[model samples]
Target: MEGCRNSKDYMMDVAGRVFVLGVGIDNVNLGEALKRIQEYVENGTAGLVVTANPEIVMLARKSPDFKAYLDNALMVTADGIGILIGARLLGRPIKQRVTGIDLTTALFEQAAAKKYKFYFVGAKPGVAEAAAENIRKAYPGIEIIGIQHGYFNDDSKIIDDIKIKKPDILLAALGMGKQEKWIEERVKPAGVPVSIGVGGSFDVFSGEAKRAPKWIQDAGIEWLYRLIRQPSRFWRMLQLPKFLGAIILSRLFSGK
Candidate 1:
């Protein structure tokens, strides 16, 4: 913890941030976000990184506890196209969407080269292990020191394991709210240099799930692709329109 600092302290020293419906998103592209996490790891600073989308923003709006967690995060990258659109509607344009999966993929390369130790937690029983196996095959020399699936009543064991392993980064995939809260309450205090709520990234890495093709992702309709693939997400996708409407109302009232 040589260069350790709290989230507020770290944020004050970083680049610009854009507020989307009271949720602050760091105005950074993928490279910048990666660089920041690398710096955090190198500096021995502990902080939580949040990859936020429209649904997450909406959830934060409804939950004070969740909002506080976002507010205190070291960095919040825009992970949804709706968030990028919302930022522009508010007259504060974001650079790009830095998705959880993309960022995690990018980190594997860095971790491989730099030998950054990683501890993965969350997803179903075999998901994290499967993801770790794929990661080892894909990124040779990357050090994944620990893996724990997100199915436990108590966190003491997990926290204890993380402390003992002393990983540079902790990737928690316990979904949105739970992941963020877990990182803030458990991982950060455990002294991990950097922790991020990776959502379902493990599923993607494990090949249990598939991402949209590059063309679809570039078209900014990855949400639609996901909806088509997982129709159950239809209800979650509704948040995009609700998010847009909220942004419009926020702009109208604030006149920003």
Candidate 2:
């Protein structure tokens, strides 16, 4: 019960919140976001950290269940350039984009130095293992207590294992919706101090997928890079324009 902070109480501290299309995105930079997570770990508070992009925000707009999850999440950082643009249009500019991969990689550095335990669950078979191995190499002393592929039919075993291992942080890369839902419904309840939906971070870490270059990411065109790299994401990329359009419409109507 101590880990489960009430959603109302969490949202009451509105100093860093920017509402975009009815979803609250924290206006913290990457360092601030990491500091909050470190606080969670130190306080032994169970929390769901959502790295929400335009796609995820749009999905939350369309789905009540998803929207509820976002509303209740302990922290929702702006994970996409579209989110920052939308916040600006809404006259509530966010500080920066705190992406899942960047946050996770930063956390690894802290975990390595602080000796925090980790449990990684998601990505394709062998992918999480590969990422774990690479992580071990990169962060020599970091403790990864458990690893599991996301291809399971039932998550009971995985949940049980996580409960037992009780890692300080749990990273689930089961894509967007599923990963968030899993972290909220399963990992948080299992009492993990910090749980995050990492999307394809494992794939990136495993070298199965390459992230966009620094310039592309800084230019806020990483979406374009991703689309160019994986043409199959054309449909997903379409969400960007839709998200921007909605923001413009909202601003026009509300005179924000």
Q: How does model 1 fare in lDDT?
A: 0.87
- The lDDT of each candidate is 0.87, 0.86
Residue 24 in model 1: lDDT: 84
For model 1, which pairs clash?
none
Off by over 4 Å in 2: 1-13
Q: Superposing all C-alpha atoms, what RMSD in Å does each candidate have to the true structure?
A: 6.1, 5.4
The alpha-carbon lDDT assigned to residue 168 of candidate 1 equals: 97
TM for candidate 2 is 0.94
Tens digit of lDDT per residue, candidate 1, span 1-256? 2111112211322459787777889999999999999899989999899999999988987899999999898889999999888888777788999999899889998887878999999999999999999999999999999999999889899899998999999999998899999899888999999999999899999999999999999999999999999999998889889888877766665534
Candidate 2 residues 100-187, lDDT tens each? 9999999998887767899999888999999999999998889999999999989999999988888999999998899888888888
Query: Which regions in candidate 1 have their CA more than 4 angstroms from the true location?
Result: 1-15
- Model 1 per-residue lDDT at 53: 97
